[model samples]
Target: MRLIKVDHIINFKLLGHGDDPLDTKKCHIDLNALRAREDAAIRRAEIEAERIGAGVTTEAQSIFDALSKTLPVRWESTVIVVLNEVRVSSPYKPENVVGGAGAANERVKKVLELERKRMQHGRQ
Candidate 1:
């Protein structure tokens, strides 16, 4: 929860709210309310933080240690996954020099693998 500050003022008929006039004692009351409100707000935020810290991370997959849980069992298997392979040939290769296109393919393969991992993590 977020707290927002609000400014309040009294409207005197003679002043007509055009020329500003404020009472300090009235402000003191508002300030006291604001202080106690702030203290209560802080306590609420700390409680929320404690709740978050207490939340259990149940069986999370490390980016390294395989997010693929649930037993990759037999042919029947415990988990199901679909892998994809795509091949695209760009007509324009940069510089068009020797081995440039082959180098590009190697780069594309790495990018594709990275994209796959990213998509999987996003699902998680």
Candidate 2:
């Protein structure tokens, strides 16, 4: 039902009196086939994207798990691990680590200061 004009030329003609009905039917069939193919392609791309996302999440979790193991259980109460866990839930991904690393380091520095304050209060 949509009109597609190309360079001042109408590629398709409306079926009317004395016009060929078969040609119009053929165009409709071709358009439906093209749409079906496009939809299938879009679905495939979405599935692939989801698969990649799951792989990335799994890798990130592994890295965090290794980091956790490197430190003692008592250290889990530390600010660094808490902040890193927060970033794990963040929209930022490992691929963007180069740009995000600086900001993350800054946050760690701030968290370190807070930890120091908490320790001082605990001793009081």
Candidate 3:
């Protein structure tokens, strides 16, 4: 008995003894095309992931906007920055507020807490 091993499965008729020779060209798999398709799919997935990661959530954006009204605020990735000193990470809880010291940081933390609660209540 003859045996053949293949990494990829392709549908083709097996040639029995005394049968006409099989066409090698028709049975070949285009590795380059397969690789290109795989690469394209990976690239598309990466692009989508990057797009999603680049934007902050509506809640985070609203908080940022509110803070911007009375304080120096900017976004560092998904984290919110205030006065270039304090960093508020996602979930935007008061405990997540960090960095800096003094009255200004405390004020920022208070504002964040209030905004977070207000937004939370507004949602319900």
**Each prediction's whole-model lDDT (CA):** 0.36, 0.44, 0.79
lDDT of 1 at 107: 52
Which residue pairs show collisions in model 2? Answer: none
- Summarize candidate 2's per-residue lDDT along 34-91 as a digit string, tens digits: 9999999999998554323232444334343443343321122211143333332322
Report the lDDT tens digits of candidate 1 across residue range 1-124.
Answer: 6555545444424645553448665454568888999999999998555323122222111211131232121111211111212232221122211232555445544543554466578889
Q: How does candidate 1 fare on TM-score?
A: 0.26
Please give the lDDT score for candidate 3.
0.79
lDDT of 3 by residue, 1-124 (tens): 8576785557779687673458675587889999999999999998555433247788777788788889977677888888889988988877888898778778888998899788879989
TM-scores, one per candidate: 0.26, 0.23, 0.53
- Model 1 clash pairs are none
- Which candidate number maximizes lDDT? 3
Deviation (Å) of 120 in candidate 1: 11
When 2 and 3 are scored with lDDT, the better candidate is 3
